[model samples]
Target: MGERIKLPNDPHSPEFWVAVRQAQGIVGPVATDTISALIDAYEAAWPGLPRKLADSTKEKYRQSLRVVREAWGNLQAESLRPSHVQALIETLGATKPGTANNVLDALRAMCRWACGPREFLSRDPTQGVTHFEQGEGHKPWTPEQLAFASDNLTGMLRRAYVLGRYTGQRISDLVRLGWTDIDDGGFNLRQKKTGARPWCPIFSELEVEMSTWEKRPGPFLLQETGKPFTTNGLWKKLDKVREDHPQLAGAVWHGLRANAVIRLRQDGYTSMQISDAVGMSIPMVERYSRYADRKAGGQAILLSMKERKQDKTVKR
Candidate 1:
């Protein structure tokens, strides 16, 4: 009988109160106030996300929301059917399984927030969604590949490449590194991805490398304007490095991070020690450590008391 309720231009906008008032007259059965309240709850829950999440992670959430809107733009929260969610996930899986699973996770959280404890929708749609399985493949750098890449990379690209391989910091944190972060001992900074602050003890070789460079005003890895290198710019440099050294084609920038992890574990660092050194989660360190152990045929050296007794007996 009255004016029809319209969704706000920004669904997250605070102007939903006006829309809610209008919706009550048109839709008498289901109150718009309830929907607005659910939306508010969802928005409130969004801000308390852990600092460990990187900027890229927030971007992924935005992308997931776009995916959701594209698939089911017309569907109301209360009217959303399980089949709709399944179809949306299927669409996402066709192009990107990993992204799709991430989207499903975000959407599931949103749906839970909207529907409360009960199944307000037809059913729980994202229950059976699965993430893509990454293959177990490590193309470790051969001597020739390493030589080619090192020889071709000149200037800052070379330095960044070498440092990444040696230190194993992710490109995100490595590029933003400044002289202030470095010292006579090592470097210390909060890892951008995990927000974990770590202190790395620099080796003599790295020390020598640092001494060669003058103290710059900005990040160690900088653009022509002396600004810190963005992730995209770093990737572009990586692409150039790969092109220059064709043998290292399959070597991703992140592979250096993996290389560092492997080397640290090989050097007899414990999982916890490596995690602290690399500014990674303990679980991630454990995963890499397990992989390293597998690669080295589980060749761990243990100083057992039984071995000590045997040695003493042999001496006697």
Candidate 2:
């Protein structure tokens, strides 16, 4: 009633906002205004992130930030309640658990960066949020499904799918795969996500797929103009391939990597060996293998039960 509070000029800087909070008595319209400015700055910074990160990873971070802002932009940063974060996560879970977790992680980082290097909040809102539980039933595909999809695929898509399955390279890496990357008995390339170099032995099946494509100097996977396929274009091609085989419409591009992991286990590769071959961390290999092993075990149990039943019928 006596006087209106004024917000700091550089609200985006944590130091500026902290000083404003300390001197201006942190409860009122000014604090709220400062929080709003911080959010605006965060949103504005999203586009520039790609300059510092890979295009694929930058897109992921941008998507995560967009979800968070859409859910909670109106609220003051300090006033963000646990219920608010929970609601955001629940909404994200409707689409994907992994995506929801990624959003939460990005939000956590933003909060930490905005507040200070040290923990500024009294309690972390996302501390106890539960993520979706995954199990072996999430295996990529059945042999029948794989065969059907492969048989229906053609052109670049056919090669792309087969390469992904056999090499276990991500879509980003697969599209850029070139003859130069392939050598005497294997392929060597650095993963865009992890920047780790992995050398995968060329299997006979993959060799057949490679033989189908002509050896060229430009991008291994390209459009008619001979340019490398963008992420969206690559997915669109895969989507078209799925359309031809309706049974595979639900299959994701990354599922090829999962299929490779399952095949590796079936071929007696240890988790560590599979992780090394796929250029993934030990933890990721272990997590993915859990599902593959569970599926394999279930199949073995079913086969054994059927055999036992046949034996009992013969004895009778």
Candidate 3:
């Protein structure tokens, strides 16, 4: 050969070699030994996955696998060790324990796939690795934070916030909300994540806010262009709004779900009632109602003390 083809500067880029192979008219699957190739093969056989992965879940996997591919794409799949997986998790856990756990989950799923009928890898690297401990999940918005958001956000963003707070729905479900869903004094929806059919009654505050809005033919929340928002589209818009308003930074959309549960609990709704209203399980309802429970307990104790003191004075 007069001259050898030069490899790309980034030696670990699986895409570069793939392009080269295509250019040379080589039409076949990549060598299965490398991690990158094995990952590709595993994804190609996605339907064979143990459980059906949702679109949102697949998006998370894609994000985690990008890091994995960058770090060990060119290495042999069999070379991945538990130590390597553990080290990666630890490094990622320093800043984002939740993300680290998600990454570990992705790795475990991929490795398990490879070790099964696929046989892309001889062993699982993530076998002994574990996820980082996570905290109490999303932080519910304080009343002050909620007031600030309500006063500041306008138009579609305001509508989005009102829907999230009052309806207690996820951003995914929120994007799909429309006038059609409104019936019998509530919004009836089959939750996308859990498939629970919840009928969230129109709260007085929500009704007052909605009464002023111009009725639309599409979804309740729309872009400035009058188009209904995709889930990612709404998230990006809300993120931009949050960035501009630092006071609203602590208030996340998912946290609104917790806020809704707490509000119902504070209003004296039972756990079963709250669960029915929010389309959440009883355990989740109890978890979110903890703050409300403490407040209610304190109020009850104080009321009992006042009654006892009044009786003592009467007897005196």
Winning model by lDDT:
3
Query: In model 3, what lDDT does residue 298 have?
Result: 97
- 1-316 per-residue lDDT for model 2 (tens digits): 6466665565445656556555656665444333344555555455554334456765676688777766666665567777878888888788787888788776775565554442344455666766665444335766777898677777777777788889888888887788998767887888887677777778899888777788879657888777888768989987776677678867877778888877888898998888778887777677767776787899999999999999999999
How would you encode candidate 3's per-residue C-alpha lDDT over 1-316 as one tens digit per residue?
A: 4456765554235665575565576798655468777666556556655566766777788898888998899898888999998898899999999889988888888888778665667888888787775577687898888999888888888888899999889999999988889989999988877578888989999999989977767688877787888888877887898888888876788999989998888888998987888899998888888777888899999999999999999999
**Rank by lDDT, descending?**
3, 2, 1
Off by over 4 Å in 3: 1-30, 46-55, 70-84, 112-128, 148-154, 183-201, 207-216, 230-249, 267-290, 293-316
What lDDT would each prediction earn against the true structure? 0.68, 0.72, 0.82
Model 2 scores worst on lDDT over the 10 consecutive residues at: 28-37
lDDT-superior candidate, 1 or 3: 3
Q: Per-residue error at 24 for model 3, in Å?
A: 9.2
Candidate 2's TM-score reads 0.68
lDDT of 2: 0.72
Q: What is the TM-score of each candidate against the true structure?
A: 0.68, 0.68, 0.67
